[model samples]
Target: MTSLRRRLLILVAAVLLLAGLATGVVLHAAARADRANRPQSGGPAVSAGTVTLGRKGRLMFLNAATGPHRTAVASVPATDPRGGRTASGLTCARFYAAAGTGVCLQSNPGVLKQSTRALLLDSDLRTLRTFPLAGTPSRARVSPSGRFAAWTVFVSGESYSSAFFSTRTSILDTRTMRLTPSLETFSVVKDGKPYHASDINFWGVTFASDDDTFYATLNTGNRTYLARGSLSRRTVTTLAQNVECPSLSPDGTRVAFKKRVLSGAALWHEYVLDLSTLHETALAERHSVDDQAVWLDNRTVAYALPANGEVGSSDLWRVPADGTGTPRLLIAGASSPAPL
Candidate 1:
């Protein structure tokens, strides 16, 4: 009987030890993720400065010296280059620039259960603020006036399980210091009527010059639509169908977006939406681009696409904004093109 008791005690002790070890492992992983977090980057002191990161391929800068390849892109006065400078300790999975402001989504350098944080930076690459995000990072954008910033994250319990997968997109008005954690809170309108649904999700918000008005994509009922939203009125209206990740042109008269087409081979085709006529034209880009198309100028659209279906092998490519010329490779091993 004593031997039996000893055996039982040993078994229970072993189980407890194993459980403790598992807990320690999880805690260690969390710590590793936290190590990658940057509440703020290490940089020189600045009361107020511009982001000086020079054009590093993906992050583009426009100035007087920049000989813009396309006609639609505005020509800047030839001046000293302002981009391509490196930001110390500031690494981003995705980055965007507009109106002298920069937004970056920094992801945990881990393979499993990773997290992301959205960071706002000034023109000098100084950290303005940081917002803890809900899931894995996807997209980030700043308003033309640098008044508003927005981002998207994809959360999943399991990488391959759609049932436990979802996305969160949020916006912050830096000028007013207000935050809209979910666009779902805004009033929804469709076809000139109030629209309501249980599964409405919004992402890829692109602000107009007014900065109070914006465009984004809404997905529900197994379909997506382009939506126009107002920051002042706090409302969104459906504008057109089959549009996702809309990037407004520099002129704000056209939007470059990804549209699903009939061909089953390529998942999406790059297209341009004329805001005045509400008409969309398919671009010459034939690859399946699943990104917000950045306007290099009023007439040139650039976006990222995976090379040869390889996941991490994405490269930047541009097509004519008018959908006339063929798509051409712009940058290799680099993406998320943001003008400086």
Candidate 2:
């Protein structure tokens, strides 16, 4: 009986030791998995050979994996080059070209500045050249080929005058820096004139891959949709309505924009519209969102969303283009995100 009791006590000790070892192994494995899925701690890890522009007017061209680096370009001054329209006060805020190169428009600094100039900068943010504008061009986009540029010019008469406000679409030749002499080929006046604020007031403009065709949103209209225009035909058509912040896919096959759908309290949702069928797939439902989207390849999109109700504390979220998966955060503590 004593021997049997001693054996039982030994067996219980061995079982406890084995159980503790198993728990330790499981905890270690879980920690390893968590480390693997964790987001890297740093700014965008751009791969070798990337050109990026910062919000503070700093342009950097560097290779992350490699040691290659280049600072600011020498030609373009850091000052904002202003031109196009006096009322809009347009500045060189962001890049709009479909090509790898960056194109920006800024109002020149001075008294009595009438027009804004389209400043062509290299990938390194070096000033290559500047194109003067006849009127104030609001949203300027370069074609995929980088050969042509299409922009919207919001024209208001002299500041003191009460003349009607008008907006015209213009296409420019990038190589020659000349406005297409055939004005009728690539231009469009808005459907109806607004009250004509002395300043330019519009969202943005974009050009098709062909450079000749383009799209613009006229806030003055009752139903705001992507207006498709033809340069050769001089015609315009409203492609889709109830959408804002239209961003074309990298392939130019479809466009992603935020559509405000009233879901029990005027909630807004974003949807991706297929240009071929004009069909849309709802991406997300949220309270408020900034109109900025970065296409992560053709199948995915990355955007920033407020964490809870605080806009200052935001996180990077990504969703599949097919609208299959749930919205997931890619990286947290990302107040502002720009896709590489």
Candidate 3:
């Protein structure tokens, strides 16, 4: 071969080899980042991973990652005198487990003239503190760090739901032990319109890791909306409508909420809304799910399926967050399910 041609070939070959090496490096870094950004199974490891649920008037631990899915390993009876079980015969309606802490909400009998309470507990079901709440309990959430807890409920004659319905949502800082009695007093900005309306009501709280930021549902002016709330500014801004019971995914990229699918009916279908794109994807669960959905992981959401549209009884079922797969019944006779 000629010397000139050989030299040119060598240079070209070296350039190709360098480009290949660079591509490999880029691929490796991308893979690592994808794994890092995925939702971790939160909290320390238990035996083969476990989940908690409220069933039969007690808190029970079940399998989270492995087989024997609905089996309960340990339990804390509602009547157990050890923890701060409230005097009103507290029955946990909504339960949240995260950041090594848990919160269980219980309420009085009816929508009006009602009282609710939040029971804060450790990983071992030992009561850390108790916060007595007002209104009829509906939804509850604790931040990923377990430093902030929030809840929402319906009150009589103050909400737009009915002549006898109103709402009260509250947040508590476990780190400082400071509580906001009601989020109703906070300023709200809806569609760029700032308002302080007597008829403004809120429900369904899902917290960000920062604990100061949260997402909730509000009912005002005969319409319901998804609202983003900031504790520092004490304000909530509306984002979308007909969305209720916003549950922030563990990865915090999307929110799983119930969207009313039926016209002139109280029935709702669950959906996931991507926060960045503001796009919503209807989940596979076409049945009316009246409760807030909980994240089993970033890819899966668990929520209770109301039996015959009844309130006090339901079965826990899980659906893919991607809106691709059918819901599989995870636990029977369980109302609320949360991964540990």
Best by TM-score: 1
Candidate 1: C-alpha lDDT: 0.71
For model 2 the TM-score comes to 0.52
TM-score of each: 0.75, 0.52, 0.70
Which of candidates 2 and 3 is the stronger one according to lDDT?
Answer: 3
The CA lDDT of each predicted structure is 0.71, 0.51, 0.70
- What are the root-mean-square deviations of the candidates from the true structure over C-alphas? 8.5, 22.1, 24.1
Count of backbone clashes, every candidate in sequence: 17, 13, 4
lDDT of 2: 0.51
Residue ranges of candidate 1 with Cα displaced over 4 Å: 1-58, 61-88, 109-113, 157-165, 262-266, 308-311
Better of 1 and 2 by TM-score: 1
209-260, model 1: which lDDT tens digit per residue?
A: 9878999989777677999999999999999988888999988899888887
When sorted by lDDT, best at the front, the candidate numbers are 1, 3, 2
The candidate scoring highest on lDDT is: 1
77-124 per-residue lDDT for model 2 (tens digits): 113111110111112523353444556655443223555776775544
